[model samples]
Target: MRQPTLYLPHGAGPCFFMDWEPPDTWARHRAFLENLPATLPERPRALLVISAHWEAPQFTVQKHPAPPLVFDYSGFPPHTYQLTWPAPGAPLLAEQVAGLLQAAGLACGFDERRGFDHGVFVPLKLAFPEADIPCVQLSLRADLDPAAHLAAGKALMPLRDEGVLILGSGNSYHNMQVMLRAWQSGALTTHGLDFDAWLTETVTQADAVERERCLIAWSSAPGAREAAPREEHLIPLLVVAGAGGNAPGAKIFEDRVLGAVQSAFRFG
Candidate 1:
């Protein structure tokens, strides 16, 4: 069986760690996770996360058996700073990924000092609370160009066959313009809903060629500029889609946030 790879629209910082009580989006977030383990193919030997937070000048890998905390976000509750997902780090696989990038003639770097960023820990803590599986995070490059990112992902393609669950953890309808708007208005707006619909139709079309084309031209999608304004969240999707290649992506979880954001998709 082809191991599955996910491109999840992880909610804002530390949202996944919150419980079901406050009647916010976190409850739904947790539920999506509760059902994910069973939905995935038998667990991979390790998980390779392409987090939006860890961007470098080029591709970089975390190389350490036990990683530390990065606390990349700020202004949240103080307890948020103390949170730790504690998944074992895969320095061996990290070296392997680095080697692959070098072999592919791409600029690659490493940081044994790096640790879990919320782009990694937040959704991961929910998806694998046990933290038993070894995890490796590949940082994004400063370049947000779609074609460049696709090549970066293709370089890591070999790892997929070696039982690494490559996950692109970022948002789909990540309109920072809308994120702040949602926070203030406390409701989904027209642009969010429209962009989300366009995204669903584009991914669910069942045409490999078309999906690939759409991803390359994603910035042109309806409300695309407004939705992504910054392409980091969307770039993560390119990694997963590039890994999928000719395969059709499985729709993992496509849902709304604040009734507007399109948090969606999983691909093989």
Candidate 2:
């Protein structure tokens, strides 16, 4: 059976590992991630995550057999930096991913030293806490072009048939400055809500062709640029959307976080 492609929100740095004043603020998001494995049709042979935390000049694959934990976030509790998800690396899948990207005419590179960054480890830890699955990390392109990432994903679509879960790890609404302001004010921001609504409509309602077109030109969506001053977080959705092919996307998770609406999607 073909595995599902996911676009998940790896929430604010170390949110799951630590407690906040409002201890239950992240309860819904945490529950969604913790229950992710049960929602999958089956255990994937291996997992491939496109991490917003990593951006290279070209598409890069992590090929280390025993990848280290990358504590990419800062100013977290002392224990957070010491956190680890000891999942084994998927070198074979990494090479296959490289070949797929090359076949797509996208430049590909390999990094033997790179490890699982926050974007990959955080959500994976929540979903598969046992750390039994082999995982690989793919870096986002430094240019952050939606079409390029989408093409890359289209090339990797074959992996789904091979039981590899391809996931795009990013947040839906990722403007820290704006999100923080809304959090402090205890109110949701209109721009963030508008952008989130537009995104939901584009993926769940639009046909494949229109979805691709809107995503390629995503910056024009209401509150898009405001929601993501930098496109790294939003660009991952384009990749997953492309891999979706004719399969419909369902909004699997949606909630208000720090006064911004965040969502996740699954494509099969």
Candidate 3:
């Protein structure tokens, strides 16, 4: 009954809920996200989402039974702020997650006050609009170290066999500066494509040891900094990679958005 894990790109700030001027700007992403539930090997019992939008001094798990929406983004339509995806939180899974991390010597805590940020809610809204699944949120470490996050993912690996879905929600290429230019020109930059190609090759390596090595040293990849700039969005992939154990990953979706190559992966 082992469940597959996912690394997804939750598109920029409320894009799914709004209309872009080009009309087709978000079409590909929207279709890909909406198809997520069907793409799964099986329906998951609970989802443990690692969000890029949330960062804490240490790892934190959401414990609230009814998690609220955080609306972490701004400058979208007024209705966008009012959006809600009222998925109940999984407190039991939170305990399990904490135990796993603590057992691995990773300092972790629980939070009753946290809510689902865009990273969790946006994709969930499209993927599972019913909001019937019990979901929990895990915060990224504020320090944003690749190895630490990868280690954290390794710690949580047991949850997959326990029927908990591990989903790392972040963008593949998250450079805002280049995104704007691509949005205007309707063309992806070479830096973004180069980095994305490197990521694809790295993650899809048949050898798990080599895949892990490449991810741990991800910064050295061509155009890595130009594509990510800040590592927040990219770090989620490391978490997913570690949780994968010996499982290999494949690019489930790949497309151009705001002139950047966006991709998603599934591990088993």
Candidate 4:
């Protein structure tokens, strides 16, 4: 069976492993991640993850055979920095991914030294706690072009049938400035609702062509800018959406975090 492509919300920096004023702040999201593997068709042979954290001038793949963790986020609990997910790196898959992108006329490169950032480890630690799967991490292009990332994803569609689970790790709504203000003020803001609704509709559209078209023009959607001041956090979805091909997408999970609506999507 072909592995499904996913776009998941990787919550605020190691939030799942720490305590918050509201002790259960990350409980729902953590549960969602924990339950993710059971929902898959079968155990994946490898995982190809596109994270919001890393961006290169060109599309890049991590080639480190024994990859380490990157403590990308700051000011978290000291123990959070020491969290571990010792999954083996997929150097061969890195070459395969680069080949796929290059064949699609997309610029690609490799990094043998870079490690998995929080975007990859934080969530995967929950979903695949054993960390036994061979994993490859791909970088978003620094340009952050939606169509380009989508094309990169389309180029990678072959991996699905080969037992590689394609995952896009990002938050659906990622305007940190706004979210922080709302959190500090204890204000209940629904600004992300419109964009969340629009995004969910676009990705879940039965017509793949239409879905791609809407995603390319996503900046014009209601609350688009407010939901993503910087597109990095949302760009991974474009890749997952592209890899989806003709498969219909479904909203697998949804939650309100820090006054912003976050969601997870599965394309198959």
Candidate 5:
């Protein structure tokens, strides 16, 4: 069976492994990640993750045979740094990914040195705890162009049939400044909800052309700039949306975190 593409909310750095003041701040999101595999069609042969954490001049793929963890985040508990998922690297899949992009007329490159960043491991450590599946990490382009990333995803759609689970790891609402301000003020912010609602509607549209059109012009959506001052996190969704092709998207998960509404999406 073809695997579904996922756009998941990778919560604040190492949040799941630490104790929060509210104690249950990340509880629901953690549970969602832990239970994700059960919702999959089958065990994936490998995983292809497009993370917001890494961006290159061109789209890049991790080609390390045994990649290490990058420990990309800081200021977390010492135990969080010691955290390990130890999933093997999918070098062959990296090559396949590069080929797909090139064939689609998209620029592609390979990075043999870079390892899995927090964006790849933090959520996967909860979802695929066993760390048994081979995985490859892909980078978003530095340009953060939605249409280009979508095209890159469309090129890799064949991987789904080949048992490669394509995942886009990033939060739906990623404006730290806005989130921090709301959290400090002890007041709820509706910008996140406004953007999430528009995004959900755009992705779940029955008309693929309209969905793509809306996404391509996503900056115009309600609260778009407030929700995503920088587009890296939001860009991953476009790739997943593009890979979705004719299939309509579904909002699989949603939660209010740090005064912002974050969500996860799935497209078959």
Candidate 6:
């Protein structure tokens, strides 16, 4: 079987599913998630998630057999905090990821105490609530550099061959504070959409070398800097691309934000 890896934009907050009105773009993603399981070519033995929510000075792997909750977000409905995503943790797979990092000339360790951050739980609850398949999560390195995250993903590439579904979860258009500000200032530009469009084209058309080059110099892309201010959300997609290495990306979902923000795409 061919190995498949994905870089998916996982938005913030669980309230995404509850919003029903226009200007609320997450509805598309929610519907997309509902269709996620049946769309898979095969059921994976395990899932390895690289969530933007989990960050560390060095890479950290979640290793508990029964990982706990990480209520990483704040200031929402009280029930949102109590939302349970009780998925079994994959300590063995987490070790393999750590070992891969070390073999690739990187420092790494385990975090048996770590819990499931919102990025993992939100997507998992929608995609695989059965909690039967083994799951593990890796943290983003401190630098948040594109090349570094891509390289880190390449290190974990072997997992795909071992029946592990590697997923790099983050958003494509992630300047939350900026976009919110642009809306408040009533001075929004086409820069973010322009950047998102350029990104989709590069991802769908470019070769591995060209794609890597674009990612490394991402700040120069049409709306690169504007799309991702901190780049934490954007970098995970690079890792997914690095892991897949020129494989065709089939966008299983696409949605425009309030007729403005270009927020969508999925790969396998």
Could you say which candidate leads in TM-score? 4
TM-score, cand. 2 vs. native? 0.97
The list of candidate 4 runs beyond 4 A from truth reads none
Arranged by lDDT with the best first, the candidates are: 4, 5, 3, 2, 1, 6
Model 4 lDDT, full chain set: 0.94
> Model 6, poorest ten-residue lDDT window?
257-266
Candidate 2 lDDT by residue in tens digits, 10-96: 999989999875888899999999999898889989999998999999999999999999888888899998888999998999999
Could you give candidate 3's per-residue lDDT for residues 1-268 as a string of tens digits? 7887899999999998888878987898899989888877788899999999989999999999999999888788999999989999999999999999999999999999999999999998999999999999999999998889999999999988888889999998899988887677766454388888999999989999899899989889999999888899989998989998886899999978677788999888
TM-score, every prediction: 0.92, 0.97, 0.97, 0.98, 0.98, 0.90
Over the stretch 1-268, how does candidate 5's per-residue lDDT look in tens digits? 9999999999988999999867898999999999999999999999999999999999999999888898888888899989898999988899999999999999899999889999999999999999999999999999999899989989999999999999999999999987778777777654488889999999899999999999999999999998899999999999998888888999999999788999999999
Report the lDDT tens digits of candidate 1 across residue range 1-268: 4577778877877876554233666676678876777876788799998988878988899997898778888777788888878999998999998898788787888988898888888888888889999998998888877877777677777777788888998887666666666667766454566667777777666887787788788877778887877889888988877776666776667666654565667766
Candidate order by TM-score, decreasing, is 4, 5, 2, 3, 1, 6
Model 5 spans with C-alpha error above 4 angstroms: none
- Candidate 2: regions farther than 4 A off: 188-191
- Deviation of model 2 at 268, angstroms: 0.8
For model 1, how many clashes?
A: 0
Could you tell which candidate, 3 or 6, scores higher by TM-score? 3
Better of 5 and 6 by TM-score: 5
Stretches > 4 Å off in candidate 3: 185-191
Instruction: For residue 113, give model 6's deviation from the true position in Å.
Output: 0.7
**Model 5: how far residue 158 lies from native, Å:** 0.3
Deviation in Å, model 6, residue 203 alpha carbon: 0.9
